[model samples]
Target: MAEDPGTALVDQAVGYALLAMAGLRADALARATPCRGWDLGTLCAHLAESLVILRETVTGTPAVRACRPGRDPVAACRTEALRLARAWPAGGDGARPLAAVAATEVAVHGWDIARSLGACRPMPDGLAERLLRAAPALVGGGRAGLFAPPVAWPPDAPPGERLLALLGRRPG
Candidate 1:
């Protein structure tokens, strides 16, 4: 059977929670990430805020109109992600439902925070397949330099590492 769209949101929740848990310690806040110049704290903040935005979108809340001023981004993201999951709705055809985008961000951004902090965490080999299958356009796409300079895997480089390089990130 084909995968349900809610699977994507679930994936995002998994990724989001994983990153938050693994990388949001006090030391992590002080650490910089590989996203050019984003500190881990700022990166998390951005992502958390983004999560709320995405949750609101999928939940059929009217466009936020404007971001509410001075809210805790992390709290907001966690709340929204939880809310989305608890209230999980049935998917109709063509529902965007926070699947690919969240997964991509969490996957990519998770590594970014790790590399910046000089900590090593494995990127799953399967991510390449998912990324390619879900959105080839993600390659050479986006605003550019979304992460640090892409890695160049020499022929001898591990396949997983090379694949990440192709996606515009240095392997962690």
Candidate 2:
């Protein structure tokens, strides 16, 4: 059977995140990331935590216990991503919304990881477009702690750049 669009989005986002994490070295964990005040290690830890939460939500199982990303964050993220992929349900209305949110979280944080490494990896065009379409709904009126104020971008900018700007990241 074909994969659900939502699930596909999550998968793609996870792929993007994993790719961004490919170059991460243990020595670089202390490097600063775009997400103000968060270091690379902290960001990776957050990503791992987010994936576990997404997995639990999708599987409808309460987490047995808190998950700690441990010493090797990259491995932790990979493990969590695998778990999420395996736990993702075949299809359900409830999964779509969670998927959208998960995709956005993973993709944006992936970008953050890349930027932290001084890489200019653009978010894939298709994924960025989809996330942009879902942004307003996912980030309704209150832009308090979750995100910074939206940054302005040229109308002709790439979808990835536009999406990054909308999410308050200064894309280059």
Candidate 3:
């Protein structure tokens, strides 16, 4: 079967998120993250939930049973990420748009995880460029509670920085 671009994008996003999660320790779970008011643990939990949603969207199967409270957030995210990757390639025709949204969510939140760890990891330039093009439609308007107002960014900024700014993150 021909490789699906959407599946590839989701794979890349999950891989990047996993890299950001490397070396995370329980002691640092309380660290503040770029997502205002959310600590690292909370952000990891949200990431795990997002992964489950993405997997369910593609697989049409409930995966939320893995998200019990007190489960290690990173482990939960890893499990769901693996499941999502496995399901995405077989996600049928309706999964493309969902793939784009999932890719964006995972990649941006991956950046957030890195930032929380005081790292400056940049999203892959190609992935950032693709997501930047798709972001306006994905996050345009009605974003009051879900996202902060868009941060102003120079037109000439790198794609990763521009994408982050569009999603209301201040890219350093």
Candidate 4:
């Protein structure tokens, strides 16, 4: 079956994230990240679990597995991301939206992972821009606990950075 374009886009973003995560060392898993109280391992765990839940939502399936710490966090994420990208239903009202959110999560968390490692790789601008436009509704105007209050960014800031700000991440 042909993949949905949104799903494919999400897959691409996940691929980039997996690449970034592949370089992380075991010791680095305990390092703090931009996600407030979350360390690298915590962020990774969230990312993986979120993907699985979103996948189940999109696929109309009961979640059968729980995310747990793995020997290789990167590999665990890669596996879950692949499952999410592949498991999107052939047709569903929520599939595209779920795919988009999954894409945003992976893309934004990709930045979080990179930030924790002090890596300077850029988030995909197109995906960030798309998510930024959809985010207000998706996240209920940055609801409490889901996201921090939106940080102010200059109008002329880079699209990806601006998107990050909209999602409550301070872009450096």
TM-score of each: 0.68, 0.93, 0.94, 0.87
Off by over 4 Å in 3: none
lDDT, candidate 3, 65-143, per-residue tens: 5558779887887777777887885546789888889999889988998898988899999999989888888887778
**TM-score-based ranking, best first?**
3, 2, 4, 1
Cα lDDT of model 1 by residue, 14-56, tens digit: 5545654454454556576656566766776776666556556
RMSD versus native structure for model 2: 1.6
Please provide, for model 4 over 1-172, each residue's C-alpha lDDT reduced to its tens digit, 9 standing for 90 to 100.
7766776667777876776676677688899988999998878778877887887777778774445534466656677877876776655556777767787888888888988898887776776677778777777854788887789999788778887888788987
Best model number under TM-score: 3
lDDT of 2: 0.84
Off by over 4 Å in 1: 1-13, 16-20, 62-90, 96-98, 139-142, 145-149, 154-163
Q: Note the residue pairs that clash in candidate 3.
A: none
**Superposed model 4: Cα runs more than 4 Å off:** 1-3, 63-66, 69-72, 90-93
Clashes of 2: 0
lDDT winner between candidates 1 and 2: 2
Clashes of each: 0, 0, 0, 0
Which pairs clash (backbone N, Cα, C closer than 3 Å) in model 4? Answer: none
